[model samples]
Target: MLLISIIKTALELLVKLLELSNEGLHRLLSDAGFTEQRAKCQQRLADWLQGVARVLTQDGRQMTGSYAEGWANSMVQVNGRTAADSDIDWTVLAPGQEFHLRGGCERKGSCKDATPLQVKEGHAQVAVGAGSQPAVTATACGVRPAQDTCHAIECCSSFFKNRIRKLLPYNFDKVHLVRATRPSSTNELRVSFSFQEKDIMRNLSTDQGQLFTLIKFIFKRHLPLTLDTPGLKTYHAKTLLFFMLEKNDTHPSIEAWQPHNLIALLKESLDMMLSFIDSSSSPNECMPHFFMPDAPLYFKNAGIGGDFDNTKARVRDRLCELRSDISGVVEQLRGLVRPLQSEKFYFHPFTLLPLTAPPAVTEIRKGMYSPEMYYKFADVYSVVHQCVSELQSESSDRDTLMRQLSILQQLQWCKCATLCMTAMAHLKFGESEEAERLAMELQRHHVVSGLKPQDIQADKYDEPAKLPEDSDWAWRFCLPCDSPPRFPFLPEFTQTLFTARLSQPLSSHLYVNFRCLSWSLQAELLRNRAPAYAFDHWIKELLGDPDLEELLTLAHYSDCRWHVRLSLQQMEMIEKERRVAMETQDEENIGWVRQKWWRVSNRSGSGSDSGAHRSSEDEEEDEERRLWARARLGLVAMETAAEQRDSWTHTKVSWMRLQ
Candidate 1:
């Protein structure tokens, strides 16, 4: 009875302890921001613990009864206190709290196996008050008490940093807001960041779109300030030009400034920038160089609001204008020469000689010459010479210009080889012999002076020499004859004493001389006869000795037309001979001759123009000849067989009579 009473007391104490633990769990939930929804959950957990404590108390009282003895004997169950008394330890699990076992746990430990608590999806509990259920809200902690909520601070800080990043060009180490009072206005906000200009420009230039956007934004805010700074202006100009060249947006705001003024400003900027490039240094030594090898030519004319089509047209016009200027300069220089030649008094910055006395300029300026002046003269002379040469046939002014250019070249004032060639080409249209003579003279002079001839005879003429036949008397004299005879002839024939030596016919030597003469007189005639004669001579020589069958085979493999023709002619001759033999009834000659003829004829048919008709005609002739030859031979064999049979019959009759 006393033990029963002790068990009842212990049960009441356990019940009180469970209630206290449940109350503590509710308070913890309220603190962790799960307050409003956790109240009912807390009540249910409290009731469950109360029922368990009541069962334990009732079972303790039943331990003294007979039914309790039977149940305990049947199950052999031990109480929690007895289990704790053995070697095992018990750990109580409270609601809303979990213990994590990192490593494997032994069964004898105080901790029991327990499943982890799964936090509600998309919700995290944040502690707000001590006694109320904890506030449950989104994982980002959107709901909480005023003092405890950090959402507004976090969001505002992130937004501030993002805006700062957009405004600044470089990465920032840290970004924050600090309150400070300003003189102009109180409670005003300002974003501050630090960056390096070099790094900013490097990043900007690498990203074209970003650079353009930044530039456009800056220009929009800062009006009336032309991008004229030393380091920055070129990049700005390049960006603007790229847009204009690609036909992108041409903002009208830039048009308020004069085009001429903008060009002048850009020119000045470019010149200043170029001047900074040291003339003595290599390109690699120049810092911040941007021009590529194939970079397009940029001029001051491509300024803002400058029409691109008009600019290109203006460039062409400027070239034409330069031609006129160069022509005028040449005229002025020519006039200077006249005064110098006439021994008239003159004063000019170009002339080094004093003009106080007669012949002073001409006499003193004989050997001395300036290379720079010569280069300029050459440039102008070439242009004038081309213009003149093109128009020489139509205009006398152009002829006079050509003559002036020739004089410049002859005086060694201009290295105008191309211009001279142009003039010579133009002159050749009317005076071919004169052009040829001049070309020869130039070649001879180059050879004498040990200089390579700039122009060769073969390069000047596209057509080969076209000597007319000797039958045309007028053309014979019209040919270019050398002053000194090219071939030696007998001199003073009337008073000559001739001696003759014993000699064989000079046909071979004469033929050789004739061939050389023909080649020299006209290259076209030589080209025409060379291939035919070469093939004919080769075949005649090769066929003379039958041992040249390998060469013939090679020729056949080459499939040249000459070889094919020769082979066909030979085959046709053989076939004709065989046919003649058959017609004459030459039986003994037919078989061997017919076989050889057929082989040659078949081989001859493998030629380019050996068409169906030609092939069929050859085949038909070969077949007819072979048939006739075979028929004639067959008749002869039949006659021989009949004669043998008659002789055998006579012998048999003689033998029978003798028997």
Candidate 2:
């Protein structure tokens, strides 16, 4: 118990170093020279997307990927892994589309119940609603081909291909784009789009997502190098969770879940997979939402065959291996269970990874940081993690606790990491004035840096899929940073002082790099957003509102430097266009041209300036102002961006055009 407190105290020191100065992440990434690579990736992707969207306007189709869903905002690709071609889930579909019964075929009553979209026998991806935003809503449309323009199922296939080719850029061949398909019933087909899979994944409750990650991480660790033992994969684990939820007919509400049932939830999720393997031992059909209604994507059992038999063998063996690891796996994960579990109403597993001490902690403390139950050290990521877990385990008022936690998680990447942690602790222990100072500092850094609402938007794109009253106590995991800290100075020149000094300065681009925090705050903090993990029934049982207000105010800021550069280049061109439009006095043209750095501001009241002579009524008024005078639509946010530093990378701010 003493060591646990020491461990918590020790983790707190790392936070101080990170937040003491405003140059933490910048310094870390500058040495690695990763900012340039990321800028190139972001710029290239942005340019390509813009070009594609422009091309789509020429035809009847639209690029719904960015607008229908938020693009990756302030994307953090840790270890050079963020820029995969797969990140872009392009949805090239016709707008306001309604399926018309085409051809002189069997009479179908309505398009809602039947779809004419079908692929040729040999080809799989013929481009029909590629897991798109439900391209067509559930409206009863059964018009003749004469009005709607489709003659046969083959025509829809050809139309889809043509649309894809039309929207694709001239260098489409150079860019690798994978198109896949899933069979719906025998004749109907669904687009096996990865973006749609992402959409589904984002819908997972915080608890469900964590459990999925835990399962996948542990499963991957034990799997063979080739992963040839069975068809075990992250997708399989995810599917297991989806079915589990569907079986209980529950939303991602955390309250529906029994308290202290983390282990039970894990076992239940895995057992479902085990049952699935056993039932499908002879190779059977498996599709997402396979057991649920609204059967858009369907898979038919391929019947008995050599290929089918092989698949069955693989699945059976894989599931059996997973089943066998239950005992060992439970023990390994049990180490991470929250302490004082009996006390809390709801506790987040946000610090789930610190079962053992992280290397950063061990190295900083020189072996004194080790938890008694574990032998090895983890990393800086794990250290902060356990601290958060400790915080969560100690509190049940998720609403209040999340404010401090969210701020810490958001600022974890900056030199402000320690300050954020300190602020969180201060808030946790009722030290509001200290917490307020740290939070304001965070706000200053965020406002000046290039951090913006879009970054948070990208971070939270999937949050809308949850119930309105769920709890996010289970938490989210983000990019685990391996940034080494600049050490404390010694007046007497201790050996430790010289050894840990930073070798490089931070790049100016570090401000834009704030999105890849090792952990993200729970959605419970957002207005109307349900806790990522909650009991749906409990939501209904609540007598009053769950205080659905955002605890923190953070905005997507396109800072001074980036704005200046844009003014010189992109804005210059826009200005010229605007001048020409003004000369012509064309209202339409002027409206179409957008100005940079312009926004709809919901600014709050100015800082408090009350004197020590204030009465009790004045103090109460000040408190009221603090509580109610911030953001009107959402949480008031801190705007972050970059200005002066060694150097920085400039990327397109296309998402700013969105509200």
Candidate 3:
């Protein structure tokens, strides 16, 4: 009894130790910006591929592998210590049924239909028909299929790869593909079960998945220590994980897959792998593919690298060492996953534009004081305009909207103007509830708060206030201000290319003012909560003369965009009202309302005033009263234009822009 009691106490202590290690690992992953960087990379890649799909007219491209699975290690010290070198697995489904081929068995004996096997995840096995084939030649590729069919698949893979290569933009050389071939053929037929793998990874319980990531991360760091050759890849670890889960499914009562048993699970998985390594009596020496169980994953004749046994032996020893010191493993893993050094103001307005390359120093000089950079901003704005307009026609869930906006913001591709456009869209759709909620949230953003009339002017006189290094402002892919972004997430980079675009003082400052146009919509929403008179004060204080107008004029000078000039004109009119309000305090509210009516009427070409022809001068004298009637009509037209323009199909001016 005492011996059993002691063993229980020891197990409890081990469990406690693992729990602590897990906590440390979680914190390390979070701090390293692993998840955020992966997300940023994925989003940027998706955007690029979306454009590619449109151009190629393909069905779609799917992101797969560890990058998609969310446990991808972007920064690793092993395997040459390269940056942004993690392989992104993509499956580009071609358009049309051109590549689809019928499958046939290689064996010549009277072929019989194979009975469908039981599969997990509510999926049934596909019944193999005699003399018939699957769409992919590689599907159910257990035994060697027809060589002709395999050759067809290889041809299809090559065709798409070549087409993609031709379509790749300049400076995208960093993203290159290395074909995975079979042992028999130098160039093997490729089959992607990435979607299936992703689904399986997604279904893993939280702890189960984390444990797998922990093991893989550690394995990556130490695998190099074991040998100088390619022994077992990360995919091998994933296959073992899949097997462990399958084993756990069969014995559900054991609950060995839970968080507390992570250490046990790791040890068990390592032991199983070690058993396979030591099994000399067994003729088969390769691990089987998880999806196609009969298919060998590691081919002895493949000539990948090193002796398989020696490699596995080293791996087993290293893993056993990690198992003994789980806490030390966690600490060592932290060193492997280095958090990107935080650079001050790494994420500013310019970083968001998705330039093909960082702006040249000469271009930066021109953009800060000249109109040369307007075209780039215009291109970014055009895409963002299309994106927002597309969004307006369709309704998305709250989470979707938040995710889209967050991605846009993180990319620095969007300014305040874009969200304002979306909010106006919400209101137009009669989604007032969501619109108000969004507007209130925008009001709280640091960018909007920084655009306060006083703050805008103060930035010029005082040293520009340093952006707070708060969580909200954290940049996913930040480098030093002088360094050009090296990742595929941004444009291409040359070794000699060095510019301060990320820290451009005037452009970043001016971007805040441009985004501040959302204040008009925010104030409009605030009107429902406050009296009508309060609306003028909100607008006057936020968009009041001098500060906002000066910024607008600067923007107009730099971009020469028609919309910027129009905005400048509108601000001038508001400035006129501010002057009138100052001189005639008694009639300030009344004049403010009249000026507002004229501005709306001008854009819509109508007013509250009667349109009926005056019979005499007496009728003309009563035009002020008639203006009230015309103003209401004009407001309705403005709203109509707003609603229509929100549709991507329409090309009319946005009502919010006029404001």
Of the candidates shown, which would achieve the greatest TM-score relative to the real structure? 3
Question: Per-residue lDDT of 472-561 in model 1, one digit per residue for the tens?
Answer: 111000001112121111111100111111121110000001111111222111223323124443344334211112122223322344
lDDT of each: 0.25, 0.31, 0.39
My TM-score estimates for the predictions, one after another, are 0.15, 0.30, 0.39
Instruction: Kindly indicate the candidate among 1 and 2 with the higher lDDT.
Output: 2
Off by over 4 Å in 2: 1-86, 94-188, 191-200, 215-235, 252-259, 284-311, 324-659
Question: Candidate 1, overall lDDT?
Answer: 0.25
Show where candidate 1 strays beyond 4 Å.
Answer: 1-379, 382-393, 397-402, 411-419, 422-429, 441-659
Which 10-residue window of candidate 1 scores lowest in summed lDDT?
Answer: 140-149
Each candidate: RMSD: 51.7, 26.4, 24.2
TM-score computed on alpha carbons, candidate 1? 0.15
Ranking by lDDT: 3, 2, 1
Runs in model 3 deviating more than 4 A are: 1-59, 74-83, 97-179, 225-230, 250-254, 279-286, 299-313, 320-328, 336-413, 416-659
